[model samples]
Target: MSDSVTSVEAPEIVVPEGVRLEPERLLDLYWYMLLNRRLEERLVNLYRQGKVIGGVYRSLGQEAESVGTAYALEARDYVSPLIRNLGSILVKGAEPVDILKQYMAKGTGPSRGKDLNIHFGDLSKGFIGPVSMLGDMIPVMAGVALGNRMQGKDSVCLVYIGDGGFSTGASHEGWNFICAQRLPVILVAEDNCYAYSTPTDRQMGNRNMVDRAVGYGCAGVQVDGNDVLRCWHAASEAVSRARSGGGPTLIEVKTYRRKGHAEHDDQRYVPPGELDTWEAKDPVARYERWLLSEEIVDRSQLDQIENRVRAKLDAAVDEAEKAPMPEARTALDGVWSTPRWTAEHPNFHDFAAEIGS
Candidate 1:
């Protein structure tokens, strides 16, 4: 990465024709999105109930985009999500209980009882945590994949960033390195069309995020992110290419963050009827339609799947609650990076003291 950017092959992965209509997978997308949305709603209710503290990210409208992209990954693969990509984390096998535990500031949480307020780092289930800072994680994800390559393991890294993040220096630097090194990273620009109160029309001088990939010298594409199947097909291809040593792929999924920016945001800048427009192409509804249209599964079958998700979530919450809190000193531990942690450094810093275990 000693460079000014150099050219590489335009990454192109073959998207299997007609995969958008896969019934079982399509319905699973619905269940994943619903579980994330519903659980998030519940968390919000609890946050108000004083059961939880600090801010939270909700996956209301962006469920399909995150879940669909994540469904394409294998279990050993890593997904680095932005704070808002709740659905992405969930799709990566992060259970509702794991999230709830963190919200509750329970010791069972991956970060332990400290810094309970910040949604940062959970290594147990392949998620490193949601970076509150935008676009900072892109290079790190690339480095993770590179490290895996060094180890001769077949893990891939999925770096999920927002459209707003694309404007950052980190995005440019990360993209440059990713291309130069030819890392097998998947750069997912979850474009829900707004960077906080600012719209994409204002921030992006260039129309397509995928277009940025051209300069990076890797393959890129965009999808109708609302259609879960469409997103899935595109992402599945990108992931497969990555697995096959096809270098990196940039995916700009056209999506929207349905809710206000965050719990504290009033969202006055949201254009009238904008949410309604996106909602019509809702991923859950679209995926469900595909499922039924294909006769892949019936309502009862879908219900059974939903029931299992519910049960899993329920049990996870209980487990998290009962999980022992990381000792107050735990944070003081693991400070000095070791070889096994052997990845690059200058990224680690402690906010543990501020949160107070």
Candidate 2:
């Protein structure tokens, strides 16, 4: 496990033969990653100020995995993002202001102040909000893919699970079910070194999680999660395969969680210098270096992109601060639904219209 934390530079960016990204799309990836980082930084500040309703999960080193994978999906495809996957949701059309409001527990949030952090989902945007229980979204996403196939829609579902979450029975059951049914679902196994404080070696016998794909009789591939373009390449292929009825694919994304499980965690269990080592391979920084080295964006262009992201975050923070909280009277508003109430409130007829409902 010590080798996993060794100091290493980012891998060279290699574009697969069939994978082509225009300059505009490349810049878009960089922008989304920057936005993801800046937004989390704002959330950390809000958490310290006591403005946040719950813990803030930071994807400090793993931004590329979320952003790149989701970028490969079409607008019609679906994704189920975990707490650390705020970048994926952003790519799926979630607004920065809504994320801020959700963290601040403002009434204007996607969850209407009912949930905190990125626990809110927008079905219309093709994303399903995650549940607290790890691996639960696996079965749920399987059902989603099945439903899409039944409806004769050529859509795929991408579900993310952590190194630890992969150990759960729910994940196994869902993986088996999807493989047997030949469902159009891509399972992303995030091997981010630790599950809370437990290292990968302590939790599972197989260090390489992607190997399980063979047992499930599905295609699988392993990629450096830090390499944004590589992740995009692999995911794009997986999406194409699933869309073409090739069944499920397991993508093992090798990454590291630079931050603790949450803001409150000090990560005392992490070995000395481990975080620093991973810091050298920071995904966002690596991608920026690639962009600059390849002359994809000059320094001035990068600066402009950073400035735009910061300005958006500033406005989002201000709006979230000014937004009101949920009223006590509305506590039970969405708790239950009756035919009479649905008829009385025509606007609330489609509960799916509400994000994360």
Candidate 3:
């Protein structure tokens, strides 16, 4: 007898104590978030110094979504984080040195001198290409989960996108198929207020992207992207559902873009008041306050975490700079080195099916 329930809905999981997390895990969790935040700041400096020749989508104030969600996934799970979700990558064990190397165009980068930041996939760690093109990878994520199900593997597929990507027809198509097939894919929508310069209000008809999930026979939840605990809870539930063949869940994280969208955007249109409001709710600060109130950690401990993160960030920069640039010929390398895109597509099933078949 097999425990397979055919329903077009998200699977539910009772939050186990192990996964529920407690103050006992505070130091680890706090440091992880701090480490990622400090890294983002340090990388931005690298970007400015021209050490990072490519570009970056800095999630300056949105650290909670990345670190919290990353903690929920098993080491073997697959994550299709968007460009802005690099924090998620870092949490999935992508080394800062390697990340900096990619930014520096180093040969040892996970992309192997191919993808310079955007296109990302690391088999060893199970985190795949950020795949910048929105809606492109949502269905692909579902397909990965489907393959895992067929192979009797417990891996779950997570797809990440932004507010801008949601406007595309692909979001609709991807969710529809995921529902009909009941694949285990989690779509994390980090609504960072602005998609480039256009505010969410200006870009989309409805402010809440989470509401759209209901139409597709899927479940979606809106959580405070800056609230680490909330993010962890939501993602953990989604992970449980997917692994149990519950199907896909969409999580719309309400957060703000603390950076200028990308390295190039000036973001001059942003009003000062709006920026100040979000800045006050900075996830790091919120989490720290919670830690203090709960006595999970104290000021000295928090300070130590900050100092350590800064040191690591500094070391990553040093390592990145000492790293060699990808060979001068490497400029042409990223787009075509792999035959995955060159081959004729078979029916989109496994990633191999989508490409090699």
The lDDT, on a scale of 0 to 1, for candidate 2 is 0.88
- TM-scores of the models, in the order given: 0.82, 0.92, 0.85
Question: What is the per-residue lDDT of model 1 for residues 1-357, given as tens digits with 9 covering 90 to 100?
Answer: 212111211112122465754555656677788887777876787777777757766656678778888888888888988777778777777668767888888766756665553375656677776555677888788788889999998887888888888899987898789889888889888778788889998888886787788788998887767766666777788888888889898888777788777787777898799878767766676666666666778889878877877787677656755777666545545554642222132222333233452
lDDT of each: 0.73, 0.88, 0.75
lDDT of 1 at 280: 72
* 1 or 2, greater by TM-score: 2
- Which candidate would rank higher by lDDT, 1 or 3? 3
| Root-mean-square deviation of Cα positions for candidate 3 versus the true structure, in angstroms | 8.5
lDDT at 226, model 3 = 80
Return the TM-score for candidate 1, rounded to 2 decimals: 0.82
Candidate 1: residue 145 lDDT (0-100): 87
From the highest lDDT down, the ranking of the candidates is 2, 3, 1
Off by over 4 Å in 1: 1-23, 117-124, 314-357
What tens-digit string does per-residue lDDT give for candidate 3 at 159-264? 7788988888887788789888888888888788888888899978888777777787777877777877777877888899887878788888878888797879
- Clash pairs for candidate 1: 11-219, 107-325, 121-129, 192-255, 192-256, 339-342
